[model samples]
Target: MKHFPIFLAMEGQKLVLSGGGDAALAKLRLLMKTEARIEVFTADPAPVIVTWAGEDRLNLTARALQPGDVAGAVLFYAADEDAREDARTSAIARAEGALVNIVDNLADSQFITPAIVDRDPVTVAIGTEGAAPVLARAIKRDLEERLPVTLGALTRIGKRFRRAAEALPFGRKRRDFWADYYFTTGPRALAEDGPQGAEEALNTLLDTHLNAAPRAGHVALVGAGPGDPELLTLKARRALDEADVIIHDRLIAPEILELARREATLIDVGKEGFGPSTDQTRIAALMTRHARTGAQIVRLKSGDPAIYGRLDEELTALDAAGVGWSIIPGLTAASAAAASIGQSLTQRGRNSSLRILTGHDTKGFAEQDWAALARPGTAAAIYMAKRGARFLQGRLLMHGASPQTPVTIVENASRADQTVLQSCLATLAADLDRAEMSGPAILLYGLAPRAALAEIPQVPEAAHGP
Candidate 1:
C-alpha cells in the first residue's frame, strides 16, 4: 500500500498549512474540528481564514512560509494552489522533522487524507491510497446516510457503562450483552427516555446478563466447504465466531480458519492418508476434553465431515464423554468436482444411483463390491484414490468393467488451484501417475466432461470405443 491508514491522535498537537486560497480554506475547516493548534501561513489571506483566527479557532500568519515555520508540527500541509510553492513549503516542513503533505500531489506527499464518515467516537475512514478518491467519497456518503445520528450517543453511554458490564463475564457473554444493548435495549430506551433512560437500560441489561446461567459446552462438527471461504455456510461461520477452541483438519483452508475468533485457540488434528497423522482417538479425546470444560469447540473439517471423515468415531467418543454435539453440513468435494466438469453424480438413463467410496480404509486399499461396481450406469465418487488407483483399476477390469468407462480426476476441487484430468478405466492409474498431482483429489467414475461430449463422436477411438 502506498499509504497505510491509521488514526493519528490530533488533540493538542501542532499542525501547519501553507495556503490561503480555496485549498487553505478547505483544510482549515477540517483542522478546526480538531483540538490541534493550526497555523496557516499565506500572503493572500482568505476572508474565512481571517474570521476563523478572530474566533480563536486557529492562528494565522499573514506572510510567506519560512524555514522552521512548521517545526515540531505533527502534520504539515502545502496546499498553496501552486505546484512550485507547495514543493518548496513541503521540503521545508519535511526537513524540520514534520510529516508533509503536498495537496493534490500524491506522488510527492508523505501521506494522503482519506474520506471519513464521522459518528463522533465512531469514525470510519475509507482510503484507496490516492488511487480513486471519487470511490472513497462515494463509500463515505453511503456510510453517512446509513449510520444513525444517535449512534454516537449510544456508544458514549455504552462506553461509560463498560466496566459495570464486565461483571457479566468475558468472550461471548460480554459480546452478546453489547449486541443486545446496541441493537435492541439501548435504542428503544433512548427513543423513549433519552440519555438517562439509556444509562438505566444498560444497568438493567448488565444485571440480567450477570444473573444469567452460564451456557453449557458443545462440539460442532463444521464443514469448511471445499476450501472456499464464500462457500462456507452461515451456521458454520457462526460456530467459528462463538467457538472458544477450534480443532481443524489438515485439508481445512487457512481462509476458513481466519473466520474464527482471534482469541480462539486453534488445534490442528490433521490426518494424512498412508502418511504420518494425528491419532483419531486422540482427536476425539481433545474434543471431549475441551467440551467438558464448558468451552464451545468447533471440529472444523474440510468438505462435508460425514463423507469419509471418520465422523462416527468422533461422535462415539463425544457420546461416551456425555458432551453435547451438533453437525453443520457443508458442500462436499464430490459435488464441487462434478460442477467443475459440468456433470452430475446421478444422471437419468446413465446412472440410477450414486456411491461415495474411500480408496483406503483401516485395512488399507478399501475393498468395494467389484461385481456391482463393474456394471454399466454405475457412478461413484472415490476419495483418497490417488494411491489406490491401480488397485481399483485391476479390481474393476477383472470384474468385467469396460475399459472405456469414463473417469475423471479432479484435484483441489473448488479451489483456485483446481485441475481436472479426463481418462477411462483402462488408463485411470497411468493417467493419474502421469499427472503427478499432489493435492487432495476425487475420482468420478461413469462421468466425462460435459464439454467433451461434443467431441465424443470424433474421439470415439480414444474415449469410448471398447
Candidate 2:
C-alpha cells in the first residue's frame, strides 16, 4: 500500500547513464532488451561497455555527467562512487522530469532498479520498495524456479499465430479453438519438443475447421459441491472433464469449472435470489436436445443433485424425452456445513433420525407433512431458510416439535468466512437478526449433543509456544 505498483511501457524512449564501471555496464546490459535510445557517459568505461561501443552496438560518451545530458531522457542512472556527483546528477535528472536511480544511494534516488525475470516480451519486475534488495532477488529466484524456460518460445508462438487468430470468422469460435489448442497440444510441444512442436501445433490448428457445429450428446446431472473445489467427488470431476458442453449454476466455484476440458462450452445458469433465473424446464430441454445429438452435456449443480436440488424435474424431462443420462453425487451443503461446525447431523442418543427439508415451498408449507419433520428424536436440516427462519420455527413448533429444541444455523458453510450461530428453536429468529447474516444458510434442529452444548472460552487461555 505504501507504493503504487505499475508496469510502465517504455519500449522506445531516451535513457541516460553516468559511470562506466561494472554497475553501469550491468544497467546498460539490462537496457539492451528495451527499444530505448541509450546514452552512456563515463571517464573510464568498463571493457564490456568499451567493446560494445567499439563494435557500434551502443552509443557511448567518454565524458563526466553534464546537465545537458539529462535533457529529453525518460530515465537516468548515476552509478558513480562520488557521492556529490551522484546527488548532482540525480537532482538534474529529476529537474529534467526524468526518473533517476543512484547506485548504492537509494535515499537520494527517485527510483530504485528492481530485480527482473525476463521472458523477453513477458518480464516480471520484483521490487522491495527500497526495503531489501536481497529479498527482491530471492523472490525473483523463486519465480525463476517455477517459470519454464520455454515460456519465451510459447510467447513467440502466440506472436506467430496472432494474425491467424484475428482473421478467424467469429470471436467465440476463435477463443474456443485457441483454448483447446493451448491445453491439448501447446503444453506438450512447449514442454518437450521446443519451438518446432509449437509450430506444428499452430499449423494443425490453423488447418482445421474453427467453426464446426457441435454434435448431439447426453446430459449428466453432476454436483460441483458446496464451495470448496477439493470437495468435488471423483465422479463429478470425471463428468466435467468429459463434458462437451457444461451448463453450470451460480453456486459452482471457478476452481471447479477449471477442471473441465478447456474445449468444453460453458454456460452460466446462475439462480440468484430475486434475480433473473434460467428456467429449469428450459435448461432441461436444452440438455435433452444436446444429448440427443450425441453431445456429452453436463448440468452442473451445486451440492448433491438429489438433496433439495431440482433433479426431479430434470429427470422427469430426460425420462420423457428418453435421453440417456447419469447422476454424479457431490458433497451436499448440509454435510459440508456440519463438518465445518464440528458437529454430526445424527449423533447417537442426541437424535435417532435425520430429515432434510426445503424452507420455501412454491406451494405453501400448508400441505407439507410438518408432523413428520417434527417427529421426536428426529433431526431436521432446513435449506434456504435465510428469510423464513421464524415462520419455519413456528411451523415446526406448532406440529409437535419442542420450542426448546437446539438449533444451529450455518452461513457460507465450508468457506473462508463461514459462521455458525447456535441457539434454541424458539430464539432462532432473534439470533439470526442479531448476527445480521444472510446468503444460503442451513438450519439444524434436534436434541443438542452434550459435547456441543458444553461452554468453552472463545480463545484458548494458554498460548502454545516453543
Candidate 3:
C-alpha cells in the first residue's frame, strides 16, 4: 500500500481549515460528523460558514490565516481551491507541526481524506491514494448499501458487553460467540423485537455456547484445481476458510494455500513421483490425530482427488479411525490441459471416447491395454507422463500404433507459465526433452494445439519401423 490508513480519535482535538468555498464546505460536511473543535479562517466567509459560526457549529475568523493559527491543531486542511493559497497555507501548517491536506493535491498533502460510510461506531473508509477518487466513492457506495444502518447500534451494544464476554475462553471460543451473536441470534432478535431483544439474545447465546463442548474436527479432501486459484470450487474455498489445519500436497499452488486461515496449521505432505515422498500411512495417521483434537482439517490436493489421487486409501483410513470426512471435487489437470490446447477431450466426430491414464504406478510405468489405446481415432490425456515418455512410446509402437499419431504436451496446465507443445508419436519423447518442461504436464493423444503447431523432430528409422 502506498498510503497506510489509520483512524485517529477526534474527541477534543483541534482541526483548522483555510477556506469558505466549495472545497472547504466538502471537508466541513464530513468533519462535522467528528467530535473535533473546528475553526475556519477566511476574510470573506461564505454565507454557509457564517451560518455555521452563528449556530456555534464552528469558530470562524473573518481574516486571512496568520502564523501560529494552526499551532494547537492536530490536523489542518488548506481547502482554498487555489493552488498558490493551498500551498502557502499547507507550508504554515507543516511549520506548526500539523498533518496537512491540500484539497485535490495529492503530492502537496501529508494526509488525504477518504470516502467514508458512516454508521456512528462503525465506519468504513475507502481510499485510493488520491489516484482514483471516483473508484473510492463507488466502493464507499457499495459498502453503504451492504452494511446495515443498525450495525452501529449493534456494535455499541457489543462494546458494552465486551467485559462480560471475557468470561468465555479467549481466541476461537470467544470469536464463535460473537460470530453467532452478530450473524444469527442478534440479527434475528433485532428483526423480531428490538435492541432490547437483541441484548437478551446475546446473553442467551453466551450462556448456551459457554456451557457446551467445542465442535468436532473434520477432514475435507479438497481439490486445489489445476494450478489456478480461480478454478477452485466454492466448497473447496469454504473448506480452506474454515479449516484450522491445512494438509496440502506438494503440487498445490501457493496462491491456493493463501486462501486458508492465517492461523491454520499448514503441513506439506508432498509426494513426488519417484522422488522424496511422504508415506500414506503417516498421512492418514496425521489426519486422524488432528481430527481427534477437534481441529477442522483440510486435506488439500492439486487436482480432482477421485482421479488417480489415491482418495480411496485416505477415505478408508479415516473410516477405520471413526472420523467423518467429505470431498470437494476440483477441475482435474486433464480438463485444464485440454482447455489450454482449445481441444475437447471428446469431440463429436473426432473421437467417441476419452481416456484418462497415469504415466506410472507403484511399480514404475503402469501397464494399460495398449492395443485398445493404439487403435484409430483413440484420444487420451496422459498424466505424470514426463519421465515415462520413452516407455509409453515403445509400448504403443509395439501394440501397432502409428508413428505419425498426433500428440500435444500441456505443461503447468491452467497456470500463467503453461506451455503447449505439439508433436507426433515418433517424436513425443524428443519433443518433451527439448522443451525442458518441469511442472506437472499432461500428454494429449489425437489432439493438437489450437494456435500454432510445434516443429516436428526427426525420428530414427529403427524406432519408426518397429
Full ranking by TM-score: 1, 3, 2
Model 3: runs farther than 4 Å from truth?
A: 53-58, 72-74, 452-466
Q: What would the TM-scores of all predictions be?
A: 0.88, 0.65, 0.87
Tell me, by TM-score, which candidate is best: 1
lDDT by residue (1-466, candidate 2, tens digit) is 4556666666668889898887887788888778887888888988888888887666889988787888999889998768888888788888888998888877777777788999876789888888888899899999999877777777778777888777665534565577666666777877677778777888777667454664345778898888788888888887787788899988777778899889888989888555588888888878877777667888999888888778999899988998887898888988887787677888787477677877776664423577776665567777877677888878777776666667888887777777888887778889899998856778777634346666622222132111
Q: lDDT per model, in order? A: 0.89, 0.78, 0.89
User: Candidate 2 versus the native: TM-score?
Assistant: 0.65
Q: What's the lDDT of the predicted structure labeled candidate 2?
A: 0.78
Backbone atom clashes (below 3 Å) for every candidate: 0, 8, 0
Q: Mark the regions of model 1 whose C-alpha exceeds 4 Å error after superposition.
A: 1-4, 20-33, 44-56, 132-147, 457-466
Cα lDDT tens digits, model 3, 1-466, are 9879999999999999999899899999999899999999998788998999999899999987889999989999998888888888889999999999998888978889999999989888998999888999899888989999989878888888999999998766787799888878888889898999988888888899889898787899998999999999999998899888899899999889889889889999999999999999999999999999888899999899999889999999999999989999999999999888887899787688899999999999989999888876689999999999999999998887878888999888999889888888889999889999988888998777766435434334354332
Error of model 2, residue 441, in angstroms: 1.9
Q: List the residue pairs that clash in candidate 2.
A: 216-293, 216-294, 216-295, 217-291, 217-293, 217-294, 217-295, 218-291
The window of 10 residues in a row where model 1 has the poorest summed lDDT is 457-466
Q: Kindly list the per-residue Cα lDDT of model 1 for residues 112-205, writing each as its tens digit.
A: 8788887877889899998898999899999999999999999999998888887867787898799899989999999999999998998788
Alpha-carbon runs more than 4 Å astray in model 2: 1-12, 17-32, 39-65, 76-91, 99-117, 122-143, 164-167, 176-181, 186-201, 210-332, 346-354, 366-378, 398-404, 414-417, 447-452, 456-466
